[model samples]
Target: MKRLVALLFALALAGATQAQDGPAAEAEAAARMLEEATRALDDASAARDRVKALTQTVRAYEAGLQAMREGLRRAAVRQQALERDLAAREEEIAQLLGVLQSMSHTPAPVTMLHPTGPVGAARSGMILADVTPGLNARVVKLRAKLDDLVVLRALQDSAANRLEDGLRGAQAARAALSQAIADRTDLPRRFTEDPVKTALLIASTESLDGFASGLSQIAADPTGAPGPAAELAKGSLPLPVQGRLLRGAGEADAAGIKRPGILVAAPPRALVTAPAAATLRYRGPLLDYGDVAILEPRSGLLIVLAGMETTFGETGEVLPAGSPVGLMGGLEPDDDGIVPARLQDPGSDWTQTLYIEVRQDNTPVDPAQWFRTDKDD
Candidate 1:
């Protein structure tokens, strides 16, 4: 009776041990699946293909977790199988022990009951123990690998966001540069035509050149003509010298205030000659000056004669200095409804002087600087 009781107790202990091992083996298998999934995710991220890889990795990790859960479920279900296997093993061990005892007691023949049987069964148990520990270790390693994959995905997302921001900033900078270029081109034309603006610009140029030189330079014509002191001085080059200096180049006061181009103060119907040998660039009506003629001299300087009675020159027509460009006319009323006798120097309230402006490279520079004259009065 004591021996039977011991056998039953051993069988129960074996069943319990098998049941514990079953779940451990399932967990190890599940961990291995998770490890594989994480590895695939890592490869996709390393390729730098897209965030789609991250999504796939996440799915694979979820699948691994699901597989792990399934493994645990299977382990629970296999508990019965573990119990049956253990029962059989325990019965075999007990039978061998019984036979050994019996053989020891037997007098005549020593019959070894199932010799080598117990050795095989013990070996199987040892193998199972070894495999279970190894599987458990693999499960630990797989979990750590999965964690690293998650971190990599996060970093990729951050990098992509920054790249997008930098691209947007570059686009905005290009737009600003284009706008600045356009503004610069329009500025010269807009400011040059305004009478008030023109006066201010001319005055600024003169001030930059100093007073005595400025006045004499505008009063004299560049043409080497023996005449009045003012005519001898190097003023704006007179392409057509027939017209007298109606008004000098500096400040003027006529109707309200006025400044004119070397206002020739010619006869009402007198022919206006080119101040210098020049090509007729443009001949048409201007906003303030009714009839205008713009002549380009060989020296690349432009002579604009405004407030004319008629323009005899046409565009692209070449005329020598002192050639007839147009005829003089009385002042035509402007937007202010005042047909002022001359242009005005807004800075000094001086009037009746000609408004002669010079430009280089389409940019207005100090005209007085180019004019020649003695410094001493």
Candidate 2:
């Protein structure tokens, strides 16, 4: 790679020695631009690796934190439920005790010893209506309390377990986040050119056409580090994210447009992973496709995952299968709180849909053939 860069540098110097005011000068500038672009690709690849590693770490940490948050939410709900149960039980117990005390109170003196008198008979009838039912009510309330107590104890145990899991998850997340930050901060770059050239290259960062043009000029195998031959694993690749498939490749949509990729139904903030070990071609906002990610699992094969609200990492990074790429977007499962409404595409109903497209030789192909189909099946 260094040799290639040196050769480009030599070309630039040669053009300068033969400096002319016509086509020759234009050729020199073109050569320099090509050289700069090539060098930028190399540097980007290295920097992106750092970004990918860090992104994976950060995503992992997020997963852990999410778990912890969910745990706390569940625990709190259970705690509230337990409190309600206790309060209800206390009220019922107090009512039952009152009935029992009333029944035990000595009968009025007029009816105490007048066994066959009118007052005594009337009092006996009152005992059947009031005292007998109170005794039965006590039995029922006692049994209900027993059942409730069992449930309350079980809930307590579950809450304790979830809280423990949350604590461990929190610890793991912190460690991963710290490590990711350190790795990203320590990464070095390959391009050490003059600040002006560096600035020019940076301007082309998000310009796909310019960047692609630069990649076109570079010879394959120039660095002797050939990329993965991902074609060999075709028809057996895994889906990047875990979820149900909403649309298959080449399927027509409601808008009467044929889809090039498959759409998968995923929750907001769900984990997105690489289907295979490969380099990330690009990760950024693309035309009308919110937060897209392009990965090269193998030479000549491009895998695109798009329609995310947020994504991690950058362009030019390579990672193993199952490595974190980014997260999907949707309203949280347990959240129904009020939020400011925003105008969205009528065709795009839920924000949780992720589009997947696999291109071989830059042509769209059926992704179902490469990935695990019938995901739910």
Candidate 3:
């Protein structure tokens, strides 16, 4: 009995050692697979919630990317290594897509046929008929693979978009560091002797009304260089992030709330850049809306960008056109902030919303009138 007990302990120790030796990347992939399994829905059930499930998948992937990014940052690592990792994954998906594409072009019979003569053809036909069940299985598997290609393509596009955001973020960080160095001695201050006061004033305000009122007390930065006049560049600025415009300015949502803004269906954690050179007015929460940012490109013209998950940059920070402001947060399965904010459409599959409101002379103006609206009609 003692010998048997010792043998059992030895076997358990070996099993533990094997588990310890498992590759971390493989472990991470397994965890992702398990998570997907938990979140999986039946084909019929998924058909009912197709768009919802896809959006959830997108958000889940984005959250995973965000988490990995945070870990890399904490470790003081660059994204090039992570990009390589993603590239390998992308290549595998691409190869699978390639196979599906080839198979789609070729009929099932052609795929089963041999390159030889009638003898080869006879042998192939007999095998095909005998293994009809497997052929049917293959057809079903091919169809599933085709569907996966679509989802994989969508995921790849999102990954590419997020990668671009990451690159832009790195550039912005470097620029911020340079500006910080310059501010110490070179850059002239317009608001206060110490800019920390301005940061506090900007961050402490709870609502937009209070922020606007406080801005009035703090004079404009004269020493700060004037950027391209946003009032003149009304119709030419590029969209802040890559996304399909879901809602147009003045378009009332299902709730019958009409807001003078455009809503974009962007990927989760999509970075928001300045459409034009502007001074950040507010970069904190306001009311029930999520994290928000108000930018003043010129007097009387305020560009408010809201519904961001995480905000960057201080309130008084001046950014050039296309500088990073913040990131779009994932609109989770439980999230309803974007829906009530009218940034989301009742019939849309948006993973996240990039809310844009252009105000002129303190009056909300249609963003369609200002920017080239590429909204889906």
Candidate 4:
């Protein structure tokens, strides 16, 4: 009987020992598996064909790791509960052994031991069965689950880091491509030839009021010419203004339209003199005409002063040739208060300008043909 009891105790001790070691073994195995998965991900990142596949694998690994982490938490909880239960059971067993020892010490008559019948034997057998095996099995299972969770967490972290790096690389590549394209393509310049004529016309109409009056007279003309009817009939018109021709008369395009005029660059605020002695036909600002002046100088020519802001003579006022009409003002500054006012060129010192237009009848004619350097002739 003593030998049988000792054997049963030995079996329970062995079972307990197995249960304690199972979790550690399982944890080690899971760690090895996680390391293998990490290596596979690194290999995928290096391979071109397998890069996409690697990304997917990394995501999967990450998910698995998260699930493993949760599992580890649960396993830890279970392990704690199991440990508490085992401790309580151990305490109870210790108390029972103490009671048994105390009972043994009590003075009692020793009775003759007799073997029970089959039913009694079976009941005794059931009572002696060890529960250590079941406890060991549960502990081993929990340990294995915890190990798997640890492995999964490691994999997930690695995958997340790789994904971040990949995204940054992709963004950088795209930016480089865009910059390359921009470098290859040449952008258009802001200033173009289309605005040349428009600028010239604007320069022609520097004075607003004079331009207006000139257009009104042309509109009221019976011969439909830009000058007085009497002057037009005689095949002569008034000189617009008196200024040295800086640019010769020619055809130029402005704002996508052809304009015929002579660019007569003059001194800033210089007095505009009439080309001939004639009546003041118009003296006001016109559309595209700044301060302008039109005079019927003789039967053959019409002079136009396009930059005059103020005029001395009214319509029908008689004036002799080379008379002072208006003063020239500089171009107004832009809204930003920045003015690009400078001399036309290094050779020409004149910054302010007045445009002079000469016309035959209603059509513009070359001023070079009729304009003389001196009025002495």
Candidate 5:
């Protein structure tokens, strides 16, 4: 019973030192990123080149919010695991507590007495002595579990405010980026777009390959082709948007339709950027692939990004690498100010799909070959 009381005291101090590990560190990292993003937003407000400043601000907000969401997710998972473990040991814990209470209340002389006489009493004492260590070990395990739960609860509570602020900041940054892109005109143009030729190409072409093949004819200036091929970036392009791969190239969908592109599941309004310096050859509704941005990195290499709610940049404009291209589409959270679903249920808010297709020499190629697909996030 004295041991049990000491174990209870130890449980109170269990997480004090342990809280600096894993989930707590994640929360701290998220806090730093959010703080940095706030400062970026402030700087963007007064920046001479608002487009570049806002682009960085939006990316910072995205990174910060992603970290904060991941921390909350880890905390949620840890809390659930702890709860399940405790629930599974409920009966054993109750019995242990009962035994401790009985020992605490019972008189020593009475406990020493046995119905089977002195021999039985001596044997019972020896058994208890041996079992004490095992019981102590169980108490230590329970203490550790309780400690983890306490820390997780505290982390969750503290993260709620930060998460909300991050989400709001991210939204504001995206809106600003969109407006900045709209008001910008400093980007160099490879050639002016021929709208009539573009319309004819769209009207005449039946497939992505055909449209890509006809893209060169739509440039108003026949001599003004995209600068140089991004040959060095062939196998090392970054994903235009942050997402998880849903399906690889040519994978059949539920409707048995197979396309020559990879599908990426992204959260709503995720920023999509140019993976390499490219000329915006075409942008708008094309075929049945929703809003699309077609980039010509060089003469024959075409990068197609489809299924965004809104597209940015003008056709014929030479966009630098990492330039904002568009945003993935999905429903916003309800007006009650609840956090995004991903915070409550990790990975659940990836409701929008971005389709990426890389074509070289007017032929569809696996996007995975060009972009690093080994990373999970």
Candidate 6:
């Protein structure tokens, strides 16, 4: 029985250690990612391609923040499971303790003896042999649960500091990237924008279709040549931002209003980029669609991204594939590093939605047919 107990105890310890390591390892890896992002930010200042470097820094921070959130979520779930297990096993734990205590205090000779006779003693011994193993198994599970609770609780406490650092780093990287984009003047210009014509076009149009049909009116004339055609990129272009599909094309919202575009639910302050080399046909507020970016990748192919808080690049500039376009808006984190309310609540925090539409020859097409949406972001 002692040997069995010892073996069970060892197994329980191992199990508890493994359980504790899972979330702890995830948190550590996330911290490393945040650290790498910080390094990237430092490197951006001296990089020949400041926009690219800052972009990488911003993306790194996003990845780290995501990982950290996932780690905390896992830890919280594990803690809850441990708490439930402990609560459910309260009676079993008490019984196990009582039995072990009673066995410990009883003299060995007394435990072996039976009140009736040698036969009764033999039977009692056999019964004890059968029950002892089960009791030890229960004891092992209880010990493991207790250990896991302690480790997970401690992990949560330590994680707060790491999470705060990562949040601050992410904010700094975003600000730097925004500045880098604004200061950029190296991108080629496809055409010069006629602001008066663009304004007239917006004032005369009430829908995206109407506005798209009149896009050419805003451009003075073609100057720089267009980039390589995006025909081969069909059905394989990455989404402009890292997010999940909130609504498919032509899906109606709660208000029963339907648009021929897809809505992508992204985290707050997420970066939006150009999925292909394209000209910045027009960017800014239009009607009730919020800030918009219209990209012309080919003569008749137009990609429109709307609902961002900010947009980058002047109209008619040729943007390379994966260039920063804008950022999704959200409430800022509180002072002292408390996570933003949006981030604290993951279920509803995808408050920022990027509206994406692909138009061919002045008609809206299903964005999914152009952008790949099968993989997790």
What C-alpha lDDT, on a 0 to 100 scale, does residue 226 get in candidate 3? 56
Q: How close to the true structure is residue 317 of candidate 3, measured as C-alpha lDDT?
A: 63
Q: Which tens-of-lDDT digit does each residue in 47-148 have in candidate 5?
A: 998877888887787777767777767777777888998999899888867767767777767887999999999999899889878877777877877878
Candidate with the larger lDDT of 4 and 5 = 5
Highest-scoring model, lDDT: 5
The numbered model that scores best in TM-score is 6
lDDT of 4 by residue, 186-234 (tens): 3221122233443454456644333432343332233332332342223
RMSD of each: 36.4, 25.4, 18.8, 34.1, 3.6, 3.3
Model 1, span 175-256: residue lDDT tens: 3322332332211110112344334444555332232122222322233222211222245454232223444445465764
- Return the TM-score for candidate 1, rounded to 2 decimals: 0.28
Task: Residues 192-266, candidate 6: write the lDDT tens digits.
Answer: 887788888988998988898798555536456666466546688999997888999999999999999999999
**Runs in model 1 lying further than 4 Å from the true structure:** 1-241, 255-260, 330-358, 363-377
TM-score for candidate 5, please give it.
0.85
Candidate 2 local lDDT, 250-364, one digit each (tens): 7788897777778887645666788887776666666567887777776777788888776655444555676667767764423211111221121222347788887776567
How many clashes (backbone N, Cα, C below 3 Å) per candidate? 28, 1, 0, 36, 0, 0
Model 6 lDDT-worst window of ten:
332-341
Error of 6 at 75 (Å): 2.4
Error of 1 at 221 (Å): 31
Model 4 vs truth, CA RMSD: 34.1
Which consecutive 10 residues in model 4 have the weakest lDDT in total? Answer: 332-341
TM for every model, in the order presented, reads 0.28, 0.48, 0.44, 0.32, 0.85, 0.88
TM-score for predicted model 3 compared with the true structure: 0.44
Local accuracy of candidate 3 as per-residue lDDT tens digits, 149-189? 33333333333444344334333433333343233332222
